[model samples]
Target: MQDLTQAAALTGPAGGEPRLVAIPRLAAGGRWRVEAMRAISEPMLLWFTKGQGRITIAGVTRGYTAHNAVFIPAGVMHGFEVGPQVFGNALFFGKDCTLPLPQAPHLLRIREVHAQQEVNVIFDMILREMNSDSPAHERATRHYMGLLGVWLERQVAKAAPEQTRPDAAKRLVARYTALIERDFRTGAGVGEFAAALGVTPTHLSRCCRQACGRSAITILQDRRIFEARRLLAETRMPVGEIGASLGFTSAAYFTRAFQHLTGKSPTEFRRSV
Candidate 1:
């Protein structure tokens, strides 16, 4: 066992690029934890060649095993607990690394599928580029990173759902997400959602729980809170104006709800960032 708090400290210095770091292997301790929010100033692509671990992003936690890869977009808060026995390579790219692919947003999760053999081979090539002592190492590394992007784009396409969620329970969850994205700022509640979806409130709640592992109200609140956070971070709107935009009649209520979900006042969060 290793001291979870100090595991990341043991890793060596970053590589030549200010925005990039080459991690040949994970920390020696099988377990590590980052107790606070960890922000990424740059995009990170982590390849877990071997090991199992758990990662929490935003408010969602998920498990990861061998051959798992994760892409953390810039500005997201995420942290991971890794098993000491893990072996992996981490690549950090600057904010301007490359244009994002059209389907990149959908590839948010670490799919429960193995990488194709060709993809694995390309990963090995990247490892070689990292270790090479040649003068052209920088060029080689950049080319390999581009290749990795192409491979990931293919994987996302292959794994994407071909059809809309067909199961009635899952469809309910999908529809809820769509509706929230469209009308979250309108302050629509679970009862309104149930009415619009043509289902009883109780039935809607049950369906949401069965498919998303969360109640309808909780999901709705989370969606609204997320939008609020985005506005706070990305826009210069006054707190009251932002709250009103989100359908809150009173800024006090919006402030309280935002604090409850994010553990910080909207003003405090905006200033801190």
Candidate 2:
């Protein structure tokens, strides 16, 4: 098994443990580390201080430029594409955190210089506290996290007036993504998911493309492959068993699908990591 304690994908706390971790946006894991479809069980704050990219959250796609902060609540599916010039930090508030936070995701474009500086200072202070060896460092970091929640609220309020409610297509895709998160491991296909949601597979795919620029089947496959990579990297489980557990009918089929999406077979991918 691999030592994945430092992996960004494992941002969720274990055994109800309270955790606060901050890491560089582009860590050593892989280029597509943060650009894959997955969901975390804790609240996350992505502070993009420089560069620009496109982020898809809750099945809605939007361009994220410099000075942007995106707050994603637990259980929301999200991913983004960033180039070499992009840089930022990802902060995770553990599952046991008690701080007040947004119930829904918020994408804030900080236009004011003061507001931009304010968020940067808050992130810096939190990071410093995290790195401190003082006995009171944990308490200090928690307080700073609270301040960040407050900052997010204020920015969200300022953007609320400009916000519009999600239309039917967005709503449907959101539901579809949520369903995917819940049952991706069960081997359910996109058609099963669409049927459960009272929609046809064609309609679901159309909405997904309109909302996130990806087809429904593509999203489903991305999610399953994402989990496959995680299992391969973090566990000693046999390759065939892992594929079966993820609803793959055969190990050979799983390998082909995994390679088609990730450019590597399971054995090769595990060894590379």
Tell me model 1's lDDT, rounded to 2 decimals.
Answer: 0.61
The lDDT of each candidate is 0.61, 0.82
Q: Taking the tens digit of each residue's C-alpha lDDT, what string does model 2 give over 1-273? A: 122122233321232433433334344577556678878888888888788889999888999988899998888888888777778778788877778899998888899999999988988898889889999998998999899889999999999999999999999999888877767777778878888899999999999999999999989898888888878887888889989978898999999999999999999999999
As a TM-score, model 1 comes out at 0.52
Misplaced by over 4 Å in model 1 are 1-64, 69-117, 120-166
Where is model 2 poorest over a 10-residue stretch in terms of lDDT?
A: 1-10
Clashing pairs in 2: none
Q: Could you say which candidate leads in TM-score?
A: 2
Task: Score every model by TM-score.
Answer: 0.52, 0.91
Model 1, span 77-107: residue lDDT tens? 4456655566666667654566353322222
